[model samples]
Target: MDSLFDVLETNNKAMMSIAITRKGQPLYSRAIGYSWYGPVKTQANTKTKYRIGSISKVFTAVMIFQLIEEGKLQLTTPLSKYYPTVPNAARITIAQMLNHSSGIHSFTADSGYTSWLTQKVTPATLLSKMMPAEFEPGTQHKYSNSNFVLLGYIIEKLEKKPYAATLKNRITGKIGLKDTYYGGKIVAANNEAYSYNWQGNWAPDTETDMSIPGGAGALVSTPADLDKFMEALFAGKLVSRASLTQMKTVEKGFGMNLFVFPFKGHTAYGHDGGIDGFRSQAAYFPADSIAIAYTANGVNTNLNNILIGVLSIVFNTPYTVPDFKTTLYKTEELDKYLGVYASTQIPLKITITKKDVVLVAQATGQSAFDLDAVAKHQFKFDPAGIEMVFDPINSQMTLKQAGREFLFTKEK
Candidate 1:
């Protein structure tokens, strides 16, 4: 597993924790980097808790299923029963919400979400942001945070308690999870790790109000605790076998709050999560009785590469850790790309800027992201597989990714 360790060592993550278990036994477990980035950086241990982001939805799905098992909820129940104002509430079913087929407009996808992320959002304000359904209910599959948020509200109403309490009593508490709970403001004394985005230096990211992501992405946990939770959940300790199978069943490429992940000669059920600077992925392969969980506080490297490395090690497949070290460009080299580029075919515009010495890119409606220099005049955003090559002579830029290329003329 030295290759797995090498990947962590080479990446610019502030902290990462990973655990792999087979048949209830740990095959590999490790934590690397610091809990935070600073001269006073606290080394991350296996117990350090990072926000698990949307992984909380899996636990939320379990609660909904538990309610279903008790005859308190029905998969076919319409949203009108609880939330009348929601668009198409009379037609959208609980199962539609569970599988992201409800067509409810995701509030996070709105252009103005970043402006309100830091402020506390009341339930009424949150509802107001729902806008309208994107399409006819149950017609097509489109993932939306609004669906999970509504499910959480339903859980709260039915349980006669807050969503956090329901989560604790119904899932975490039942699974004996010691380090999993709803997160709030970052409390350093509590050993909660704040997330960061890496460029040349680790830049701290803003924390979203927990209320904004509640029941959808508010839970904080260590990888070990998450691995334990998934094991118990799949072993029929959290939900019934019937409900578990339903959660695993996919429709239009989406299951009930779960996604299908196929690995070497085996299929696994899992979810990937991202909120703020933290990202996570966890999966369980029943065929092999193996479970793997990874959490990161800062990610400058592509997460897929890390997961592929870990899984390859678990399956005894040959894998190589990537060499991430790259050549540094001087200030003069960066200044040449600092300008606005516009494409006639697309309404979006790309603006590149240099902060100190780090190159950053911002498009219409999106926040700026640091772009790493992969080669002279060629920079890339690894997370999105976006590569930008600049032609100073023609004053043009070529953007390539996903087997397509677009050319943009540099604007004076």
Candidate 2:
């Protein structure tokens, strides 16, 4: 139990909150780190709210199923019934959108997405920006943000109200989730956590407009509220048992806004989400009658590793606390790894740079990330499970990841 706290302190997340329950009884609940960074920092607590990101998809799915239960919607309904001009509208069904098999282009992955992601967007404007479908409807599985966005729009249309209002009346209000709601600008007074990208110091991350994520990634919630929601959802307080079964039915590795996570021969159904610097996970294991939720405002370590640690704690399994201390490297020593390195094995190039005595690595068409040095000429990016060993004398580097190695030579 102490080891779990040790892991949180060592990982140094800006804010980390976890809540776990079994048989409808809470087993553990904890929160650590600061909700706000810098001189005017505010410590996080069990009640602090964090943007849950794509976990909102799960909530959106719940609302859709509720509508179906009320005879207001049908899973087999075609998209043309709502928006005929949408690509593949004639062929795509509501179920395809729910399971992310709609073949619609993911607007979040579009080339210009980042350019305007921070700005507010109207529904029509956002839909107009969506690219044509990439594949025939239901022919293949493809996770797309556009699908959830469209679903959100449908929820709004059918409810004759805004998405946030529908969520309040149909879900959160019914669950009595005091700490969950639609997010807006971070207001320190309300205990909303500010997301950050961690390096040697916390760097404030850019805020994505809530309107852009909409039902895809806009909801804010605490771990406790998330756990409660999962419990009620599985207990049939939200949707009918038959409808819940459909949401859990897997097709091409995806269910209706739910995904299965295997742990020690047991499967948990839930979703993971990331938006800016916030990372979230919520899952419920019906066999064990357990529900767990974790939310973080900032992370430098791998998120999966964190989730594994929380699960291990809940299950009373053996787990080791990570050693967060880093070996300091001189500025001159870090400069040696600075260069553009390319690998013949893959059509990608990595440019390493020295930033304030720390090594940073950036790949082609990707954002730069700080690489922590473990030893002389050896640096690692833990988030991606990647390690790089630089041989400055030969102007070459070897990258090791998941038991595979790639060799790169510095270009002249």
Candidate 3:
């Protein structure tokens, strides 16, 4: 797969560690980039670990089902049994939270999330952030990390142990996922990869405090371990087939934490994870008995673009690799677009500024992100699927993302 770099239009500009499995056996594995970037770079390998982020929700869901099997809980159990103070807690069921229909506001999606991302949080802190239910429980579906965080707490309450210990005693130990566990501060000496985002070079990304993510995210693993977890979970070694079916159930693209991943005529069930600058994925195709897992500590372009390229080759389908071409504009050339811009369609305001040769953009209370210049007056932040076309003459910027467009007029 060395040629994958060529097709990826990479000149060591991307980082990846991937493993493929079929019929519960390893089929392929590859690692690229450094585990620790410094004076003496430490090259990453298959054993190198990464924070799997929200993929930990799949593990959380599996444990929740296991508790149900043991008669310790039920899908219809009211969340108020554990946290009665939460708004509409009595009306929210375990199943609703599992399927993301609980209406619990996502704490991480809050505008102030970035400010405290690196600090530990208390139950009271997280509880305070759980805004009033956006809708009646089970009336609609919306993705919320608050749901999983509460579920994680419930797991601790039922199992009489911390989430990490329960994870080991229940799943990883039974399944032999040696490299998977609750994570702490990253230690390069332990082969934990530090994540980065590229501007003109790889800039170290801030590490979100582990305590804050809780069961919604906080787990470190390798691609191989993730592949193993998916294989075992799908093979009924982790949960019963009935429970697996429950996890695979979806509405509006989210399922208990499992998501619908459609490529061609094949449907794969799995989850994608991201934290700080790290990104990871694990997808299983039951029909083909194939499991694919990948982790990236650094990516210079749209990661889905990279994943599709890898999948097309694996699935034996013809694929077209895009040409990676961009024109560089001097920092001074971007001065015309620097200002606070507000949109009529969205509540948030976007501020644009340039650092060195990179054009950076920040939204309302969100973190600032660097945008790459793809063409004159056109820029993109591929990581977030955001593109901007600046009409400097009109003092306006058209923002496009996920097939939606909004016109933003710069503040005078």
All candidates: TM-score:
0.91, 0.95, 0.87
- Which candidate number maximizes TM-score? 2
> What C-alpha lDDT values do all the predictions have?
0.86, 0.89, 0.88
Better of 1 and 3 by TM-score: 1
Report how far off residue 49 is in candidate 1 (Å): 0.8
Candidate 1: the clashing residue pairs are none
Residue pair clashes in candidate 2: none
Report the Cα lDDT for candidate 3: 0.88
Clash count for each candidate, listed in order shown: 0, 0, 0
lDDT of 1: 0.86
Q: After superposition, how far is residue 24 of candidate 3 from its true place, in Å?
A: 2.4
Q: Show model 1 residue runs off by greater than 4 Å.
A: 10-14, 333-360, 390-396, 408-412
Better of 1 and 3 by lDDT: 3
Query: What is candidate 3's CA lDDT for residue 33?
Result: 82
lDDT of 1 by residue, 357-407 (tens): 678999988878888787878888877778899998898999897778999
For candidate 3, give the lDDT of residue 371. 82
